[model samples]
Target: MNLSRPLLAAAAALLTLSLAACGSSKATAPGGATAEVTVRIPDPGNSGVLALGKKDGSLDRALAAVHAKVAWTGSAGPFAPAAQELNAGQLDFALGSITSAVTALATKPSFKLFAATDPDPVGEGILVKDGSPITSIQDLVGKKVAVNQGGTGEYLLLQALAKNGIAADQVQRVYLRPDQSAPVFSSGQVDAWATWSSYAVAALADSGAHFLATGPALGSDNYSVWAVRTVFADQHPDITKALYQYLHDGDVRAKADPAAFLNVFTDAGPLAVNGRSKQISVDFGRQNGVLSPIDDTVAARFDKVAAFYAAQKITKSQVDVRPDLLDITKLPGGSR
Candidate 1:
């Protein structure tokens, strides 16, 4: 179902919170102790990154040094909703894909991207049923493809298709949530599905889908980013720094032991589908410790995304993606 323009407008309204209340803390800790920060994480699909934080005591260890308490919250919906809550001053931190962050910035420019948890954003890709004759972007002409609107999945597909000289009108676009797109794809309702990380891996395993191309093929530096409200960062700079460190540490642990990471995912909750966990375990290894620096590749990818959005008329004006919205140098350790 298409989300009504009015509903989306309302969402934009609720999503807009003033930065005036940004640095104010509701409660102060005793004896000048650091205030506790609540972190809201959208469900990791089958990643188990959240559970790992709890089990490894990484959250505790990271915050302990700063004398701050870490309150963890999770949701199963798209990252946009939780990020909206963060924009509304209900959350201190939130996890989201790079595209989600970009959308959030379009509405609320007060949030700052701090670090990247997943190394490559473009790892996500379009999956077609195995044995399908579709071997390249040109082959997708006149076929139905599913993707989440305004998401990395959609963005990557747009870029890939454009790079291959495929006209937008040549293919039918079916906007579906990542979860819904999978079943539709498996049922042959759509010729291909664009998805990322856990869901993409799950589709490959369950449906025997062949990869058209991954995000990296569209652009080398496509990667997800972790960001917090600007006020939260300004008020609690130490806590923000600690959180970045914690994410970096988690990446280290994930690299050293992926099976251990899968166990964490399984223990936290059942995978949306079985056998998907195994695939995720193998994929996470390739992504581990790959989150250190933002290079020219990332900047170039952002430019590509902005240009695509402009061409699609997704924005009324050109998006200036530097200084105002992206200040990579401000990240922990002054950017890599």
Candidate 2:
């Protein structure tokens, strides 16, 4: 994830432009700006569930109650690097995978973790076309696989293969964004695609596609957590709390009616999927889809990711994330 200076600058500029689309104005709050809390979610094309919140007004309605506001800036790469955007002031809040956050947090410890979600253990995984000769992770040797840097795809693929006796050098890992991976995997250009959530579901919809392995199989203690830039959290603690509170409420509403939620996603989503989002959303909701505040066990889980990455040498040095984790009180189920 070594971003060049020019590329980093460009990414920051793109994020800034995206934030501008979120709209800003002259206003003052107890902390500072009141116009918008610019947050970035993984922009997995139109099928992204996060986009639904922006379209259906659920996020807005939730924010309005707390006298808070949010401006979504969808980042196109690994959702993990949104933490980098947050640290760079290109984003205020971002949601990411456990592996992505822990790995990125190793380098960007300035990010603060507040809340975490218990993603379906099997929700994310390596997907391959049904008729492929590949059967086990061992078969990945000398095969091309699509993954995203700063995403679970690469991590899962690496761990799954290694466990089955394939080393990193034995396979060809093609790094592609979620959007890019879908069509590539669909066209049979790559042997497999490793991704999660709706994007994974979209790939799965190809009746010919099937799961080869999953995060759980590789001992991935995954969670989708929302984190923010430490400075922003320090300056606007109330606003941060309001955002998470709204998110918790939205989760409750989402669970109560997964189908309805999917409709909003599909209706608002620009991608023409044949009910992929619907199926993924409903099943995901039933997969212990509840969120919990940051606690010791969860924090340890994040620590494990750091250690995992270090052992894998994906990171040059070890990073301590506990110092940056903040326990925000007064969440839906109450904070730890």
Candidate 3:
């Protein structure tokens, strides 16, 4: 293959960065040069750190301990796309939902889940117009429910329906993003909406909106996972561990100062109804416990999620979440 000098240089630089990023933990890269940690951000994935980073620079201080700075990669949301970008090798580390990772892996993407957070199970919910007389999950049967296809919203709805004795095939699902879901839901375009995080909670506060059920109310303990390409993890175990610590620190700081980190999560989008920042913070803390190493409980939870996705046909391919979880032993925290 023929290559211009500039093209060759860029290729070489990429190779060097990748090697440095995935290499064993050291004061520097294989060549003694440190690589910055590239994080796909502005989503729920890294919102805690992003928010804390903005308010007091706590995330920065954590990053500095490993001598790595954060290089913002993609400025997108809902977590699904960011995970896709990471799997494609266009980005480095990513924040993703367990459902998103499972769906992607069912298709055989070279991805891995490094760490996990179980955000308040109730953080996600099935929403309806306030005072509409539909008070429980059973009411959603035959009703049009708005959800993000191939995301948490779908399975969360599925689980809710099953618990209420409403079959999955009974409800009409309107595939809508968070931005679209809120407005359409308010305008009566859909009978209900299912979503997660501060966005889901914000929608519930709408004068015309109320929750029929939440993740917990529906028997869900789904998790938000931190992931990287397997190839990347194989090469940079130390850097991978560093990232988990930094994010865990962010979660800790946010919990200690809940009022301080509210806007960070809300920054993903607007809140038509003014949100309760402190409550959101505490709830977020409750939903997502300390960032921890993946334990038997984590693996078991993921297995259930995989089986659920397969049953729901969210992923047409065979699903096995076990292979996708990357175990890092030397990390400061013993979670994974």
Candidate 4:
């Protein structure tokens, strides 16, 4: 579902204030140097990256180092709105799926990717009703499938269907918000739901949906990243570096003790899955001081995503994912 105009306008206004906050003297660098930066976090899921940032104080720590302010905002749709805010100079940075980041860069070349969060983007997966007759991906033919259109959820489902020789035209596609899809799945309106971690896991727990396919199975990189406006980066390079360093450190700490990360999830409210944190993977690594990119297998998964989107005619033009969009080397400790 598309976000209402009022919601979009409010987000835009909040973004403007956030940008203005960054421009104030509070965001200046050490020794009284002038620098302002604000990071806008889009709501993903209960245990997603944004939740992790809140739990571990990653944003606070990162902004503290740069003396910048963090304005966390809830998003209703995909990265399009957030990307628009960034392009309008209303935001300094955003955290979202790799596909979202790619879309942002494809349309607006002024942004640059700084870090990868999950190490493997292809790790995302899809779920179907448990104890149902739909055991294999091929069974999805002619079935009603729910997904968040133009987002990672949609991309993952498309990739899974293509891999199983199931054509998109053969199935009934239902596009809904992540929250809206959850209830519909619970009510048994949809045959299956394609989603990402935490939300997908939670939906399965609530609706008895079993894992049908994961990002890796469908050739996805299963990763997310941080993207920032180039102008913001150029004006506040030190803050950008410090933000990456702080987030990398938080990831390291979270991996060392996954349970500690759960506190953030608990504060946010009940997770999608009850007591399923133990079954989920929360490992994060840092190279040098910045978040690391996905390994070869993971990168291959992203390649498949680009191909699937192209095949579906999601975009009018070919997506050239190179140094311009997925630049992993530019991060402070990215080379490692």
Cand. 1 TM to true fold: 0.80
Give each model's whole-structure lDDT.
Answer: 0.65, 0.70, 0.70, 0.64
Put down candidate 3 lDDT per residue, 206-302, tens digits, no spaces: 4356667778887775788878777756765656776777777777876676555555545545422235544654665544666777777888988
Best by the TM-score measure: 3
lDDT of 2 by residue, 54-89 (tens): 677776665555445666565555655576677777
Q: Please identify model 3 stretches exceeding 4 Å from their true place.
A: 1-22, 25-47, 264-287, 331-336
Candidates 2 and 4, the one with greater TM-score: 2
TM-score of each: 0.80, 0.78, 0.81, 0.74
- Give the lowest summed-lDDT range of ten residues in model 3: 38-47
Candidate 2: residue 178 lDDT (0-100): 76
**Any runs in candidate 4 off by more than 4 Å, and if so which?**
1-61, 75-78, 118-123, 265-290, 293-304, 326-336
How far in Å is the alpha carbon of 204 misplaced in model 4?
Answer: 2.5
Residue 81 shift from truth in candidate 2, angstroms: 4.5
User: Candidate 1, 269: how far from true, in Å?
Assistant: 7.1
Candidate 1 lDDT: 0.65
Better of 1 and 2 by lDDT: 2
